[model samples]
Target: MKNRLKVLRAERDWTQAQLASALDVSRQTINAIEKGKFDPSLPLAFKAARLFKMSIEDIFQDEVSEEI
Candidate 1:
Protein backbone atom coordinates (compact mmCIF):
# COMPACT_ATOMS: atom_id res chain seq x y z
CA MET A 1 0.00 0.00 0.00
CA LYS A 2 0.98 3.59 -0.59
CA ASN A 3 -0.27 6.60 1.31
CA ARG A 4 -0.19 10.38 1.31
CA LEU A 5 0.24 10.50 5.05
CA LYS A 6 3.46 12.52 4.97
CA VAL A 7 2.01 15.06 2.59
CA LEU A 8 -1.18 15.35 4.60
CA ARG A 9 0.77 15.82 7.83
CA ALA A 10 3.03 18.37 6.18
CA GLU A 11 0.06 20.28 4.82
CA ARG A 12 -1.24 20.60 8.37
CA ASP A 13 2.25 21.36 9.80
CA TRP A 14 1.95 18.30 11.98
CA THR A 15 4.97 16.41 13.28
CA GLN A 16 5.03 12.62 13.25
CA ALA A 17 4.64 12.71 17.01
CA GLN A 18 1.61 14.93 16.74
CA LEU A 19 0.00 12.68 14.18
CA ALA A 20 0.80 9.66 16.32
CA SER A 21 -0.78 11.32 19.33
CA ALA A 22 -3.92 12.04 17.41
CA LEU A 23 -4.05 8.52 16.06
CA ASP A 24 -3.20 6.87 19.35
CA VAL A 25 -0.12 5.29 17.80
CA SER A 26 3.61 5.60 18.27
CA ARG A 27 5.65 8.12 16.38
CA GLN A 28 7.63 5.29 14.81
CA THR A 29 4.36 3.85 13.60
CA ILE A 30 3.53 7.10 11.91
CA ASN A 31 6.95 7.20 10.33
CA ALA A 32 6.62 3.64 9.14
CA ILE A 33 3.25 4.34 7.59
CA GLU A 34 4.56 7.44 5.87
CA LYS A 35 7.50 5.51 4.50
CA GLY A 36 5.32 2.70 3.19
CA LYS A 37 7.10 0.23 5.43
CA PHE A 38 3.93 -0.55 7.32
CA ASP A 39 0.24 -0.74 6.65
CA PRO A 40 -2.31 0.46 9.16
CA SER A 41 -5.10 -1.72 10.40
CA LEU A 42 -8.64 -1.10 9.10
CA PRO A 43 -9.64 0.62 12.32
CA LEU A 44 -6.62 2.85 12.26
CA ALA A 45 -7.17 3.71 8.62
CA PHE A 46 -10.76 4.70 9.35
CA LYS A 47 -9.63 6.81 12.31
CA ALA A 48 -7.15 8.63 10.10
CA ALA A 49 -9.77 9.20 7.42
CA ARG A 50 -12.13 10.60 10.01
CA LEU A 51 -9.43 12.86 11.41
CA PHE A 52 -8.52 14.20 7.98
CA LYS A 53 -12.08 14.35 6.74
CA MET A 54 -11.05 12.21 3.80
CA SER A 55 -12.09 8.80 2.59
CA ILE A 56 -9.67 5.94 3.18
CA GLU A 57 -9.22 5.74 -0.57
CA ASP A 58 -8.16 9.36 -0.55
CA ILE A 59 -5.39 8.76 1.91
CA PHE A 60 -4.33 5.22 1.11
CA GLN A 61 -4.06 3.78 -2.36
CA ASP A 62 -3.92 0.15 -3.31
CA GLU A 63 -0.80 -0.36 -5.39
CA VAL A 64 -2.57 -3.17 -7.23
CA SER A 65 -5.21 -0.73 -8.38
CA GLU A 66 -2.55 1.36 -10.06
CA GLU A 67 -1.43 -1.64 -12.07
CA ILE A 68 -4.85 -1.77 -13.70
Candidate 2:
Protein backbone atom coordinates (compact mmCIF):
# COMPACT_ATOMS: atom_id res chain seq x y z
CA MET A 1 0.00 0.00 0.00
CA LYS A 2 1.08 3.55 -0.66
CA ASN A 3 -0.02 6.49 1.44
CA ARG A 4 0.11 10.26 1.33
CA LEU A 5 0.70 10.48 5.07
CA LYS A 6 3.96 12.39 4.81
CA VAL A 7 2.52 14.91 2.40
CA LEU A 8 -0.58 15.36 4.48
CA ARG A 9 1.47 15.82 7.61
CA ALA A 10 3.77 18.24 5.89
CA GLU A 11 0.85 20.24 4.59
CA ARG A 12 -0.39 20.62 8.16
CA ASP A 13 3.09 21.35 9.52
CA TRP A 14 2.82 18.39 11.84
CA THR A 15 5.74 16.36 13.05
CA GLN A 16 5.54 12.58 13.14
CA ALA A 17 5.29 12.79 16.92
CA GLN A 18 2.42 15.25 16.67
CA LEU A 19 0.59 13.09 14.24
CA ALA A 20 1.18 10.08 16.46
CA SER A 21 -0.21 11.97 19.39
CA ALA A 22 -3.30 12.90 17.41
CA LEU A 23 -3.80 9.31 16.36
CA ASP A 24 -2.90 7.83 19.71
CA VAL A 25 -0.07 5.83 18.24
CA SER A 26 3.66 5.82 18.67
CA ARG A 27 5.87 8.14 16.66
CA GLN A 28 7.64 5.12 15.20
CA THR A 29 4.27 3.80 14.10
CA ILE A 30 3.54 7.02 12.22
CA ASN A 31 7.00 6.88 10.65
CA ALA A 32 6.50 3.27 9.62
CA ILE A 33 3.16 4.11 8.03
CA GLU A 34 4.62 7.10 6.21
CA LYS A 35 7.50 4.94 4.99
CA GLY A 36 5.09 2.22 3.85
CA LYS A 37 6.56 -0.25 6.30
CA PHE A 38 3.20 -0.87 7.94
CA ASP A 39 -0.46 -1.00 7.03
CA PRO A 40 -2.91 0.46 9.47
CA SER A 41 -5.78 -1.58 10.85
CA LEU A 42 -9.30 -0.82 9.66
CA PRO A 43 -10.11 1.12 12.81
CA LEU A 44 -6.92 3.07 12.59
CA ALA A 45 -7.57 3.90 8.96
CA PHE A 46 -11.05 5.10 9.84
CA LYS A 47 -9.61 7.26 12.58
CA ALA A 48 -7.17 8.80 10.15
CA ALA A 49 -9.86 9.44 7.58
CA ARG A 50 -11.96 11.14 10.18
CA LEU A 51 -9.06 13.20 11.44
CA PHE A 52 -8.11 14.40 7.99
CA LYS A 53 -11.67 14.73 6.77
CA MET A 54 -10.71 12.60 3.82
CA SER A 55 -11.89 9.30 2.54
CA ILE A 56 -9.61 6.30 2.93
CA GLU A 57 -8.89 6.30 -0.78
CA ASP A 58 -7.80 9.91 -0.54
CA ILE A 59 -5.01 8.95 1.83
CA PHE A 60 -4.07 5.37 0.92
CA GLN A 61 -3.69 3.77 -2.44
CA ASP A 62 -3.21 0.24 -3.67
CA GLU A 63 -0.07 0.00 -5.72
CA VAL A 64 -0.30 -2.33 -8.68
CA SER A 65 2.05 -5.27 -8.51
CA GLU A 66 3.74 -6.84 -11.54
CA GLU A 67 3.41 -10.32 -10.18
CA ILE A 68 0.72 -12.14 -12.05
Candidate 3:
Protein backbone atom coordinates (compact mmCIF):
# COMPACT_ATOMS: atom_id res chain seq x y z
CA MET A 1 0.00 0.00 0.00
CA LYS A 2 0.97 3.60 -0.56
CA ASN A 3 0.25 6.35 1.94
CA ARG A 4 0.24 10.13 2.26
CA LEU A 5 1.97 9.97 5.62
CA LYS A 6 5.09 11.87 4.59
CA VAL A 7 3.14 14.61 2.92
CA LEU A 8 0.78 14.88 5.83
CA ARG A 9 3.62 15.07 8.30
CA ALA A 10 5.38 17.70 6.25
CA GLU A 11 2.26 19.79 5.99
CA ARG A 12 2.09 19.85 9.76
CA ASP A 13 5.82 20.46 10.18
CA TRP A 14 6.11 17.35 12.30
CA THR A 15 9.27 15.30 12.54
CA GLN A 16 8.98 11.53 12.25
CA ALA A 17 9.85 11.20 15.92
CA GLN A 18 7.19 13.69 16.90
CA LEU A 19 4.60 11.87 14.90
CA ALA A 20 5.71 8.58 16.38
CA SER A 21 5.38 10.00 19.86
CA ALA A 22 1.87 11.22 19.15
CA LEU A 23 0.93 7.86 17.68
CA ASP A 24 2.58 5.89 20.45
CA VAL A 25 4.84 4.09 18.03
CA SER A 26 8.58 4.20 17.53
CA ARG A 27 10.25 6.60 15.16
CA GLN A 28 11.46 3.63 13.15
CA THR A 29 7.90 2.46 12.69
CA ILE A 30 6.83 5.83 11.33
CA ASN A 31 9.86 5.89 9.09
CA ALA A 32 9.07 2.45 7.75
CA ILE A 33 5.49 3.43 7.05
CA GLU A 34 6.56 6.61 5.30
CA LYS A 35 9.02 4.66 3.19
CA GLY A 36 6.39 2.08 2.31
CA LYS A 37 8.50 -0.64 3.89
CA PHE A 38 5.70 -1.49 6.31
CA ASP A 39 1.95 -1.30 6.33
CA PRO A 40 0.29 -0.25 9.57
CA SER A 41 -2.24 -2.47 11.32
CA LEU A 42 -5.95 -1.69 11.15
CA PRO A 43 -5.97 -0.12 14.61
CA LEU A 44 -2.93 1.92 13.78
CA ALA A 45 -4.51 3.10 10.57
CA PHE A 46 -7.63 4.10 12.44
CA LYS A 47 -5.56 6.01 14.96
CA ALA A 48 -3.83 7.85 12.14
CA ALA A 49 -7.11 8.66 10.44
CA ARG A 50 -8.45 10.04 13.68
CA LEU A 51 -5.33 12.05 14.30
CA PHE A 52 -5.40 13.58 10.84
CA LYS A 53 -9.17 13.92 10.74
CA MET A 54 -9.22 12.03 7.47
CA SER A 55 -10.73 8.78 6.39
CA ILE A 56 -8.39 5.80 5.97
CA GLU A 57 -9.03 5.86 2.24
CA ASP A 58 -7.82 9.44 2.22
CA ILE A 59 -4.53 8.39 3.72
CA PHE A 60 -3.83 5.02 2.06
CA GLN A 61 -4.33 3.60 -1.40
CA ASP A 62 -3.73 0.41 -3.33
CA GLU A 63 -0.68 0.60 -5.55
CA VAL A 64 -2.36 -0.88 -8.60
CA SER A 65 -0.72 -1.35 -11.96
CA GLU A 66 -2.24 -0.63 -15.33
CA GLU A 67 -0.40 -3.40 -17.14
CA ILE A 68 -3.70 -4.97 -18.11
Candidate 4:
Protein backbone atom coordinates (compact mmCIF):
# COMPACT_ATOMS: atom_id res chain seq x y z
CA MET A 1 0.00 0.00 0.00
CA LYS A 2 1.03 3.59 -0.62
CA ASN A 3 0.45 6.51 1.74
CA ARG A 4 0.66 10.30 1.81
CA LEU A 5 1.78 10.72 5.40
CA LYS A 6 4.92 12.63 4.53
CA VAL A 7 3.13 14.98 2.16
CA LEU A 8 0.31 15.65 4.55
CA ARG A 9 2.73 16.20 7.40
CA ALA A 10 4.80 18.51 5.25
CA GLU A 11 1.72 20.49 4.33
CA ARG A 12 1.20 21.06 8.02
CA ASP A 13 4.85 21.95 8.49
CA TRP A 14 5.40 19.16 10.94
CA THR A 15 8.68 17.36 11.46
CA GLN A 16 8.75 13.57 11.41
CA ALA A 17 9.44 13.68 15.13
CA GLN A 18 6.49 15.98 15.67
CA LEU A 19 4.17 13.72 13.78
CA ALA A 20 5.38 10.77 15.82
CA SER A 21 4.92 12.69 19.03
CA ALA A 22 1.39 13.63 18.10
CA LEU A 23 0.62 10.06 17.19
CA ASP A 24 2.35 8.67 20.31
CA VAL A 25 4.78 6.61 18.29
CA SER A 26 8.53 6.69 17.88
CA ARG A 27 10.24 8.97 15.38
CA GLN A 28 11.56 5.96 13.55
CA THR A 29 8.01 4.70 13.10
CA ILE A 30 6.97 7.91 11.37
CA ASN A 31 10.12 7.89 9.26
CA ALA A 32 9.51 4.31 8.27
CA ILE A 33 5.94 5.07 7.30
CA GLU A 34 7.01 8.12 5.34
CA LYS A 35 9.63 6.07 3.49
CA GLY A 36 7.17 3.27 2.72
CA LYS A 37 9.33 0.90 4.70
CA PHE A 38 6.45 0.13 7.03
CA ASP A 39 2.69 0.01 6.91
CA PRO A 40 0.60 1.18 9.86
CA SER A 41 -2.01 -0.89 11.59
CA LEU A 42 -5.71 -0.03 11.30
CA PRO A 43 -5.78 1.95 14.53
CA LEU A 44 -2.71 3.91 13.53
CA ALA A 45 -4.25 4.61 10.13
CA PHE A 46 -7.39 5.91 11.80
CA LYS A 47 -5.28 8.05 14.12
CA ALA A 48 -3.38 9.57 11.21
CA ALA A 49 -6.58 10.28 9.31
CA ARG A 50 -8.10 11.85 12.39
CA LEU A 51 -5.04 13.97 13.03
CA PHE A 52 -5.03 15.30 9.48
CA LYS A 53 -8.81 15.70 9.38
CA MET A 54 -8.90 13.44 6.34
CA SER A 55 -10.55 10.17 5.56
CA ILE A 56 -8.46 7.06 5.43
CA GLU A 57 -8.98 6.69 1.69
CA ASP A 58 -7.73 10.24 1.22
CA ILE A 59 -4.30 9.29 2.55
CA PHE A 60 -4.01 5.63 1.77
CA GLN A 61 -4.76 3.83 -1.47
CA ASP A 62 -5.19 0.19 -2.24
CA GLU A 63 -2.29 -1.65 -3.76
CA VAL A 64 -2.44 -1.55 -7.57
CA SER A 65 -2.55 -5.33 -7.64
CA GLU A 66 -5.71 -5.18 -5.55
CA GLU A 67 -7.41 -2.50 -7.57
CA ILE A 68 -10.05 -3.36 -10.10
Write down the TM-score of every candidate: 0.98, 0.92, 0.92, 0.91
**lDDT of candidate 4 over 1-68, digit per residue (tens):** 88999899989999998999999999999999888889999999999999999999999887885686
TM-score of 1: 0.98
Which RMSD values do the candidates have, in order? 0.4, 2.1, 1.8, 1.4
**Which stretches in model 4 have alpha-carbon errors above 4 Å?**
65-67
* Worst 10 contiguous positions by lDDT, candidate 2: 59-68
| Model 4 per-residue lDDT at 20 | 94
Residue by residue across 12-52, what tens digits does model 3's lDDT show? Answer: 99999999999999999999999999999999999999999
> Compared with the true structure, what per-residue lDDT tens digits does model 2 show for residues 1-68?
99999999999999999999999999999999999999999899999999999999899887874233
Deviating ranges (above 4 Å) for candidate 3:
65-68
The C-alpha stretches of model 1 lying farther than 4 A from their native spots are none
**Overall lDDT per candidate, in order of appearance:** 0.98, 0.94, 0.95, 0.92
Report the number of the highest-TM-score candidate. Answer: 1
User: Which prediction has more favorable lDDT, 1 or 4?
Assistant: 1
Model 2: residues with Cα > 4 Å off, grouped in runs: 65-68
Over the stretch 1-68, how does candidate 1's per-residue lDDT look in tens digits? 99999999999999999999999999999999999999999999999999999999999999998999
Q: How many clashes (backbone atoms < 3 Å, residues ≥3 apart in a chain or on different chains) does model 4 have?
A: 0
